[model samples]
Target: MRGFRPGLVPTLVVAVLVPLMVCLGFWQLSRGEYKRVLMQQYAERRVAPPMDSTELAQTTDPAFRVVELQGHFDVEHSILLDNRQHDGQVGVELLQPFLDRATGAWLLVNRGWLPWPDRRTPPVFSTPEQPVSVQAWVYVAPGATFQLHADPVAAPWPRLVTAIEPDKLWAELGRSGFSYELRQQGGPGAYRTDWPVVSMGPEKHLGYAVQWFAMAAALFGLFLYLGWHNAGRPHGKHHESNQHV
Candidate 1:
């Protein structure tokens, strides 16, 4: 009870901050668990046999599945993902629209990363004219980290963008397509497609949780120290005086 009474100001500050710190710690813990499950799913799905466009469309979540698609590249409308790097060189990633041979639906395919041979002009890329079967892993749209500017309005062919969103691309192209990107597996139209296994792993989340929890503990300790120090009690209260003068 004595420690609980940390005066009005200290009580209000502790009430607001201590709970906030504790909530953040638990939130990180939940994030760590979610990451653990996601990592497991990615590991298992990446090795499975590649799926066709129809099968891929039916699947609920297609983040990292290796898929096999028979399609012809829409070479004329190819776009470049700006500000990409390859082997310590500044460049861009080529993203081409694909016309699926089976379903006749359009899908965006990441060809690969290319160095900026000339920053002033766009590099010329050779695209296959014939129908080709491509094996690639499914990757969703660019996340918040990739975004530097607002999604541009209707732009010319071979657009340059800071972020890639399937819906936005479809809106610009005026066609329907799969909502995910295909990181070219092999064959023609390939670039540095190798990506990190996990964006943020469980270990990193756990470390963040530890930091939040530590802050909560430190806040609790400070509150206790303030209360104990502020309580009016003499160093030798018992021996000082038993009767008033």
Candidate 2:
């Protein structure tokens, strides 16, 4: 009929959409579990042998993990990531390249943390020259961002670096070693490596999951009511010609 009841079509549409929404919500629930498991494995596998960075593919498994490379710290090339702040204090972490005297393999070490006075104020440093061992985890460099002075083409130290280019560093050293950046584990340095607290913004996945589930529930209830309304109407008077499409 050209003239329809106020809530008839919406009720029918809602009935179907409810189930569709529930299915989607449960799918996300499953996905969350998957991420949790992978994270747990990553934590557990930290003690296992470190993978050769060049051989590792992009993976969520924890098998490829932290490493211990013994060599002297090349502090001359050592630099700090700019504008890194932690606990409301402005500071930078020390990143030094550790060259293995035996195998010649090297690791770019984020040795530790430091405090700075102002954004304009460059941090002070006093890294020792004696051979030092570095323990770190392999981390792929993130994408380019504005505001941070991450330059890859320039010289290693005192030159602001915005991104981690293993290829460029390897070239700077005259030989390629690994593909990932070394996240320094605490050793014999006063530099800070405390993980930064990321602000949980509105764009996070968990918030979206809740919204989707609410919509699904509303749809399911509407559909159930419609099904009953049509079924319980006086037999034949239920209007056979008015069947929902």
lDDT of 1 by residue, 1-245 (tens): 65344578877888898899888888878878876877687789888877877888788888888888897998778788888765678888889899888888888898888778787887767888888998888875324555546757777877887777877788877999988777886687686776565567778888988998898889889888887776655436554665443
Put down candidate 2 lDDT per residue, 13-130, tens digits, no spaces. Answer: 7757776777777766665655555455556656677654433344453232776566787777877766666778777767777776656776666766688776676677877677
Best by lDDT: 1
The residue pairs that clash in candidate 1, if any, are 112-191
lDDT of 1 at 76: 79
Segments in model 2 whose C-alpha atoms lie over 4 Å from true places: 1-35, 48-64, 140-152, 196-204, 212-245
Please, what is the whole-model Cα lDDT of each candidate in the order they appear?
0.79, 0.62
* Backbone clashes in model 2, listed as residue pairs: 15-223, 112-191, 112-192, 113-191, 113-192, 150-161, 150-162, 151-161, 151-162
Candidate 1 deviant stretches above 4 angstroms: 1-5, 83-90, 117-124, 141-148, 232-245
Compared with the true structure, the alpha-carbon lDDT of candidate 2 equals 0.62
